[model samples]
Target chain A: MTGQSPIVYPGRMSRWEPQARERLVRAAVELFDEHGYDSTTVVQIAQRAGLTKSTFFRHFPDKREVLFAGQDVLCELLAGGIDAAPDEATPLSAVAAGLEAAAGNFTPELHAIGPALRAVVESNSDLREREALKHHSFADAMTLALRRRGIADPAAGLAAWLGVLAFTDAYACWIDPACDQELTALLRLKLRELRAAISSLD
Target chain B: MTGQSPIVYPGRMSRWEPQARERLVRAAVELFDEHGYDSTTVVQIAQRAGLTKSTFFRHFPDKREVLFAGQDVLCELLAGGIDAAPDEATPLSAVAAGLEAAAGNFTPELHAIGPALRAVVESNSDLREREALKHHSFADAMTLALRRRGIADPAAGLAAWLGVLAFTDAYACWIDPACDQELTALLRLKLRELRAAISSLD
Candidate 1:
């Protein structure tokens, strides 16, 4: 529901003021976990983050945007990686490069919040739909990037879709507390597994 | 927006009178093409079909339902195919079987309307979101069906997702007038191509 542009706040805040956004996210996740997404409000999230409601609004347009703000950054990383790949790179290779670039954003602290974020998303149908849309948006961005590299229709689309599938599988595995593997390592492993599975298909 | 249950129509019409539903769909598609989806009314669709407004309500709950009515049938076909697969069938094989079963539903007549349907869906963001949701629902149904056969978590989800990707790619090709292949054959070819693409990945 959040339609706010992802522009940085000028003048009053330094570019390094990442704490405000991060704090609001943390507070939203905690409150969403304690109560439900429907019952939580911006005032409560701001209060929990030791900030005012206006400050929360400056960062995110709505509570839903807090959970999804990372998607914009990830899409940019993916597109940038694809654009920076060698001119001779194949469609699948370009997609892999994009995914690898995006993987860098999922730091250990981000992984720590994965489970709670997933739980909050899974509990709400609207959130689930939004998540699916975000995933589609990522794939669409990848497809366009691949096409810019001179890839054809179905190949660009298929490679992009497969890349997203691998990313999703890797994220699920990396979020498990028992799995100590890093996100990049998990992504590679998932991609290999997907290749093997595809090879085994009748 | 359609929330109508799929219960059989009451004593007013025989089960064999599927023409009512088909006519309504044809009328709605025509109206949606001539006018935008947002401007088309259920009463107009019924009128164009030479049926009463109540008859339209009996088949679909709302205007949006007419466009997505096939999804339920496809999901059932997919699940049934997986359920009927041999016990020793691999997860991907089961997924292929499900896709093949669902492919039967895409008759030549339906393929003829593919471009129109795609145009209508692509023109509206709401319709695009609904289409993505339908795609997710199909994947979810396939995953559950695979799990019923004792397939593991990530594997089941991955196989189902790949199957849908193949289906999507194949459908795009099948709908092309220049491409004369049948839907089933196109699906098999697309699956083979996907496997080759994955194999070529580094």
Candidate 2:
């Protein structure tokens, strides 16, 4: 599905026009939130976004993709951050750097959407299963990144898993309506708490 | 579909018996291994077990349930281990104790079945997704157990996640034909490596 919109491209939009994609995602989330995920259709999402069905198809293969489109970008951000870490940095520190870089992308606007997104996912068993796989993929990416840094097995894998745990736990706290702390701060707190917990183990 | 065999029973077999359930599981796994998971049916499984479809239903609600029937027992064993840990143990130590207790249950016979079990799970995306949820459930159970011991937020959650990671990683290695170490030893090694990895982080 391809289409040429009548609107001319500006400097910002010329590189890669994301307006249509953004609109589709917003529309999909809103509709999924209002109606159930199974009840909502791609045609309805495209219509809600004021875009043609072709445009929606161009951005996402199906309705599920709207919620998960960021996974690849986030994975790259995490890996790139780890690759960019200082040579002397330990595996976990490099992982922390990657997590920090990823956290930078979760702006307040994204955090605001967390509850509704979580609700939608939690409502559907399929969505919940997909989300779990996505989380596992994140851990897998981190493990490979650590391996690239010359970290060995067990250590590399464990560090990656721990980093994921910190990120997931911090995000859970950061998304709470009552949480006043920034995500970066929460991430740091989580990492520290993890270290303390491990240290306390005999 | 019920039948009374000619064999005499002990006191335990005279009452609620698990021999039929065990037979069903063995038959199911054998059938799933021989035939593909999708192709295998309840009737076939029951017949292989020398029972009836009604008997299979009495044990497992469905074919998928046969694969996941161990989850509840494993969860309870983990929670019980945590609860039985010495009161003075740290959160992570308590978690380690729980993991060790669970590892004790993975006998040589069980380890021998791991490859086949893993094959069955890996062949189906739905099974893999359910396995991930089961893992998350284990972590949740451990977290609740840790909280019961008066451990705080991030520490309790992190410790629980780490415990799961250790158990999962250890089991993966332990299932390998090349692995010569015991499950308990591998688990300890994994936990130590995790501790070292986190300790090295600055």
Candidate 3:
């Protein structure tokens, strides 16, 4: 799936060489695919992007983090969505709102790179561990957000975990070549299915 | 607290020194608490245990792993518990069984080490990430076990996540010196509370 054309985002990214972060991401993903993740170096990514090694270090601490850019932004989006939800809404409804808030991040550009990112991450144990921790990050962010909205203890935590699960499952489905549904729709469906599945647990 | 008395295990562990793995774990915990996890070296841990560095390596791959021993064994215990449950048991019931099975490892010695382990892990980011991945591992093992029992998708996965949440919450409570309940009882209570919270989600 790695191609020569600059990956473009509809809302924010530019035509060819976007912002520094985009350029770095594009360069890193391409290099990771072509040279193998382990073989690709930060210097090479920087060189491919016409940026200095120091600039690369400024954007990301390490090469493994290049693919995981915007983690904090995604967490902010999830929490912000919940924060903006109506006071009268239920906890899961707020969580659904959080999911919807995070929907903006699932651009077709991210779709284009999903397979390559998945391949690179799954091939390495350290990357897999990082990905798992990412799930925890999302859950923790959403849980704290829910608690702030007056949802208490295990209920808030439970709803947040459900949100993370739905988002993770839907993101996987969206990355699959056979899936036609939008990420938002898939997220809603997955959340509903999980809610339904709760009764089946008994 | 790390003490002069040999940590005793009622079911399996010996009074002092115990097995090589236990000895390594004890030595590592002591060293970690005294020197801080970042400052502690594998050689120091080995030396503290009156063993060579190679013997320590034989028991654990790294210093960080000494505290996380028996992960596979716990996974197996969880799966085996689910396997031994009656076929007619509900998914949560089977999960409760799994938690009960894993409870054998929670000797008073582990409880004694709980606060110290928490302090060491919380003081470091790497340990926190590894700790998060451990939760993922337990959830995965339980998910696969539930699926083997003919539980369906989303249901199996959801149930497994609930089991993980319950186990994690109960673990925290069990570690609290103020709490008097048994881990098994705590697990059951936490599971029920989460199950009840699911309905509130809607």
lDDT of 2 at B67: 80
Candidate 1 — which residues are off by over 4 angstroms? A1-20, A41-63, A83-96, A107-109, A147-155, A177-180, B1-20, B41-62, B83-96, B144-158, B177-181
What's the lDDT for residue A28 in model 3?
Answer: 91
Off by over 4 Å in 2: A1-18, A51-62, A107-109, B2-18, B107-109
Ten residues in a row with the worst lDDT in model 2 chain A? A8-17
Q: What fraction of the true interface contacts does model 3 reproduce?
A: 0.89
Per-residue accuracy of model 1 over A69-180 as CA lDDT, tens digit each: 7888899998888888999887767877898999998877688788999999999976887888888998989989988987775667767877888888889889988899
Pairs with steric clashes in candidate 3: none
Local accuracy by lDDT, each model = 0.82, 0.81, 0.87
Q: Write down the TM-score of every candidate.
A: 0.77, 0.84, 0.90
Query: Of 2 and 3, which scores higher on DockQ?
Result: 3
Off by over 4 Å in 3: A1-18, B1-18
Name the candidate, 1 or 2, with the larger TM-score value: 2
- Give lDDT tens digits, candidate 1, residues B1-202: 1676345556635464467877887888889999989999999999998887887887888998888878988999999999999999988779888999999998766776778888898898767777888889889899899989988755777678778888888988888879999889988888777656554444
Residue A28 CA displacement from its true place in model 2, Å = 2.4
Interface RMSD of each: 2.9, 2.3, 0.9
Error of 1 at B165 (Å): 2.2
On a 0 to 1 DockQ scale, where is model 2? 0.45
Model 2, A1-202: lDDT tens digits are 2555546465323234467766777788889999989999999999998877776777787899788877887888888888889999988789889899898788666787788888899999778877887787788888899889888876777777778888888988888899989999998888877767666555
Per-residue CA lDDT of model 3 for A19-125, tens digit only, reads 77878888898888888998999999999999768668767899989988978899999999999999998999999999999999877878888888888888887
Error of 1 at A158 (Å): 3.6
Rank order (by DockQ, best first): 3, 2, 1
Per-prediction DockQ: 0.34, 0.45, 0.71
